[model samples]
Target: MKLQYWGTAAAEGLPAIFCRCETCQKARERGGKNIRTRPNAMIDGVLKIDFNADTYQQSMKYGVDLTDLKYLLVTHTHSDHFYPNDINMRRQGFANYCGNKTMLTVYGSDKVMASILPMAEAKSMAGLLQGVLVQPMEKVQIDKYTVYPVRGVHAAAAGPLVYAITDGEKTLLYCHDSGPLPDEVFAYWKENGLRFDYVSMDCTSGCSPMDYDAHMNLERNIAMRDRLLAEGLADGKTVFCCNHFSHNGAHSLYDEFVEIAAKEGFITSYDGMEVEI
Candidate 1:
């Protein structure tokens, strides 16, 4: 399976729209991978993990053919991850392109469905927006691939979600906009005994204050990697990666953060980074 990183910034994005911090300033000055848009990824050009506010630009920048994508697996309803209005573009008479025969199917938790329904209803129900409310640990099939939505504790009121996908060959666990791995996730790992080929975790806090319940710092990120390894959920062959960075992280530039991550045998994901598992 092929995984492409479209964007790699947290909610605020790198060189955040309204910030003047030194890191943001430096990111602006550097203006390459340092200038991130928002977090989103596409797997094998068919399934997208998250559709953020920056989806348009991210897709354009990456030369992604959005219309052909088969699935959109949303992680959560966080503004940075889910933008209902953008998705409404798929509705007939809304966008320029003719619709695909197989409408892009979306999978997410109840909270995600709630956030999307209103806009979809407004767009006219023409099968343009199809969806399935994914349950925790329940495997759903999209073509030949299986998708699992693991409940995340990012938001207390609304249960946040993350994803794991496999094509019966390789599995990738996308853990973002989330803090520590929930117990249910560990239980699923134990019950399934599946070893993930790639694990991309949230490093929203960078190296700053640690908040394991809401986001992860560099230290906590490494700790999670260790625990996943110890639990046999992943092995050394796993491509451990970190992403979803906040401007507040200790590293002011992409290279600065990447240097440290590389030293620890971790890949610091940047916009346009591609991995084949």
Candidate 2:
């Protein structure tokens, strides 16, 4: 399995759209890892996580052929995570795409389905759809992949979801757009002793010590990692990577995070970061 980090920024992205913060300023001056797009990822060119507004730019930047995607797993209905209008591009007559009668399975929580349903209604392409299909949460098997939808703790209105995806040999925990693990999720992990080969967690707050309602700071992330290790949820074989960083987190460069997380046994994810498992 191959995991590619398409975008690694929080809501506004590094060098944020409007602000002139020091971090954004530095990111503008120095590109590379400092540059970030909205949050999204691709797994083995089959499963995609989150459809942020920056999807187009991410595809162009990484040379991703979106037509080949088999599944789109949405975390929530946040503007930065799920952009409904952009998805319409995959419909007929919008963009020149390939794939024979390609059926794109989109999975998410109830709110995500609600958000996507209206768009399909307005466009009236929901009937003649050749490339997309929206599937609500359940343990669904699509294109040789088994995905488990877990409740996510985030916006009450959005009703978020996190995923545990398994493509036979390896399992990945696509945990973002969420806060601390809920008791049920913890119990599931505890009872099953299910270990993830790859973990892409939420580190939107970066190095802040402040507590956030739906995001994790660097300190919280480290503590969470320690807890995971102590509970046998993670081991040396598990590759832990952090993403969804905000410009407000203070650190401007991705290398800085790599250096910091290295001391604590985490791989800091940046745009275009890829790992083969």
TM-score of each: 0.94, 0.89
Q: Best by TM-score, which number?
A: 1
lDDT tens readout by residue for model 1, 1-277: 9999998899888988899999998988888889887889988888888898899988888887676667888888887888878887776666555544446778888888886666556546455667778887788898878877677758855557777788989999898778887677888877876789999999887768774488887787799899989999898899888899989889836878999888887889898999998
- RMSD of candidate 2 to the truth, in angstroms, is 2.8
lDDT, each prediction: 0.82, 0.76
- Positional deviation of 127 in candidate 1, in angstroms? 2.6
Give one clash count per candidate, in the order shown: 0, 0
Task: Give the lowest summed-lDDT range of ten residues in model 1.
Answer: 94-103
Q: What is the C-alpha lDDT profile of model 2 across 99-162, one tens digit per residue?
A: 4545566777777777666555645344423323334245667677677667766776876777
